[model samples]
Target: MTISSTPEGVSVQPRHIRFDVSDDLKSFWHGNNAFRTAFFNALSLQFPDGEQQFINAVRLYRDRIEDPKLQAEIRGFIGQEALHSREHKSYNEALKARGYDIDAIDERFARHMKWVANLPPSRQLAGTCGAEHYTAVLANAILRHPEWMEGATPAMACLWRWHAIEETEHKSVAFDVYRECVGDERLRRIVFLFVTWNFFKYTFLNTCSLLKTDGKLWSVKTWLGGLNFLWGKPGVIRKCLPDFLAYFRKGFHPWQHDNRRLLEKNLKELEAAPSAH
Candidate 1:
């Protein structure tokens, strides 16, 4: 399949905004709901090392990409992901300071990523592309529906939305790079299946670990509520299934599921709320 370009009007620019996620940050910051808060915290824990993996995977093909525009996007992708890693590192530190065993969780992910680092460069890039699609799908949902952040702490809300906006903007960078360098559709599809499995496995395990630390792991009410939130009304993951599955299509491209309007609207809102960042 041919490489699909990032859509016009979508700019992969980095927003160097620092969030105030300090020690005083509440453990149940999402509407005082342990499940929701733990769910998001679980994601933050993965970003630092995960973002670096993405950066490294894309950088493998940097010199081979002769197109000036794609090269510029590579720089932008690396910059945005680097800043993401920094902010999430600080965010995760706050979680650790709050007495959660985030170090263990972080180390677990770090170990898995180390294994990924040893894979063939093309496989690594394919994994990056798969992970990017996952983020882009969830990012689009968060941007399209404001209620996802309804009860989140202001700073946390802004940080996540900013992340969502940028994820939407640069969703196609790694995919483009992979297409240009490898263009192995079968490999991309197969790797995406594995990525999907690990994504859910680790996210669930990490969320459970955080909840257990909070003494909410055995709370049936917490499990029921969190399960409902993800699979019942509003069904965030359920809603994303179609978009996630699209990656397996023969000629699929990240830009094919364009949501630039959502990106533009959320960006304007984010810019207006400078203090939120």
Candidate 2:
């Protein structure tokens, strides 16, 4: 992927750090861990290919990247994304083993990506960046909403928790990369924010729909539990949203949150816990 902005201008480089997921929380799904299993299965099927497309979109001008620093950052970004997709693939297998409708989920998910990939560059950038905003927000919310995972099914909790940690950790890389690569900041922000709010609404609402479809809807215990655990907690939004919106401001940095502490804490615990089959 080519980054128009170099360190001479701007770009996203790789940072080494794996997120820690709590063993206790691994099993926590909204209701049934299998519901989450299915969701993940779907996500894994969609992401790698979609990521390639997104990468290709950036590659549209790979040779144009004149800045060595920015080029390295782009390589790092791609490497991390590749790692993420591979790890998720392993996780998705666990979901299928747990009896998720992985095939069905993948079929539909592939269709969506196909549609997304067909969109114009402007729209594609918006969707990708917008989705990043949601992930970034949700990631921070997960860390702040520790209580939300308190009683979740262990496997499911671990999955989302690990993903959240990584997302939060890498939150700004894509946006910053995009800003450095693409056109006017003002236009990017407008499209970015617009895609963001809409994607968020779609994701949560769709998650609800999926839960119901999978017969996990009545898991109100999990539902309300997640809410109270995450958004319901004091300072949940404060800890997260400001970071998200702060993107509009100069000198905003996701690293300021330093979620690695939480990841490390969880990893030690996972290391001690028995692995789930």
Candidate 3:
């Protein structure tokens, strides 16, 4: 795809970390809010399969890339996402052991990715770029707001934060691949619109499925609390609107937002923390 040069001061380094999720880890690991916790867990269910889709989408044009740095970043991006898929599978398995039906949710998501795999390569790459931007925006929010993961169990929090750090690190790889290979601005925007719709719709449906299985779907308190958490006070999703909309800018680049400092800080912390690789 031959991007002219990598984004200034931005590159991805893959980290392999082993997170030990406790046997007692509950489904409601985040602040004891079932809906909030379920929402994040639903997102987790998407990753094992979703990440493979991203990897395949980017690899379609890998040989076309001419820049050494971008090529290295692509490798790093693939490696990081591969590890994420593996660890999230373990995380989902832990949830399943807790009696949650996360494996069913993951299987359904895998079916969706299978459909995505059948699309044209350009369309597939565009979809990957769209989802990467979504992840980058959300990762930026998680890095910026400590309260988002407040009260989460230590192991669970470490896993989420680690994923966020690596997502931030490789946020632009797929977008740059699309820009360099497809160069279709209109198609990119249109695909993002579609991806936005499907992303939210599926996430909502998945969260509901999780909630239903956990016997919290009809809980008014759970709904109210979850709604408030996402759209009200702390407003993780609400506060991300600006960054999310920035994706549509004429020369939108993930590094333009420049949250690399957060990634750096996190890497340092994780390196110092006692953990197995």
Off by over 4 Å in 1: 1-4
Sort by lDDT, top down from the best: 1, 3, 2
Better of 1 and 3 by lDDT: 1
For candidate 1, lDDT tens digit of each residue in 86-142?
A: 998988888888888887998899999999999999999999999999999999999
* Separate clash counts for every candidate: 0, 17, 2
lDDT of 3 by residue, 231-260 (tens): 998887889988888878897888778776
- Quantify how close model 1 is to the true structure by its C-alpha RMSD in Å: 1.6
How close to the true structure is residue 253 of candidate 1, measured as C-alpha lDDT? 92
Worst 10 residues of 3 by lDDT: 1-10
- Cα error, residue 238 of model 1, in Å, equals 0.9
- Ten-residue stretch with the least lDDT total in model 1: 20-29
Score candidate 2 by lDDT: 0.54
User: Clashing residue pairs, candidate 3?
Assistant: 1-64, 1-65
Higher-lDDT candidate among 2 and 3? 3
The list of candidate 3 runs beyond 4 A from truth reads 1-11, 22-24, 275-277
Better of 1 and 2 by lDDT: 1
Compare the candidates by TM-score and give the number of the best one: 1
Candidate 2 stretches with Cα past 4 Å from truth are 1-53, 141-148, 151-170, 218-223, 234-239, 247-277
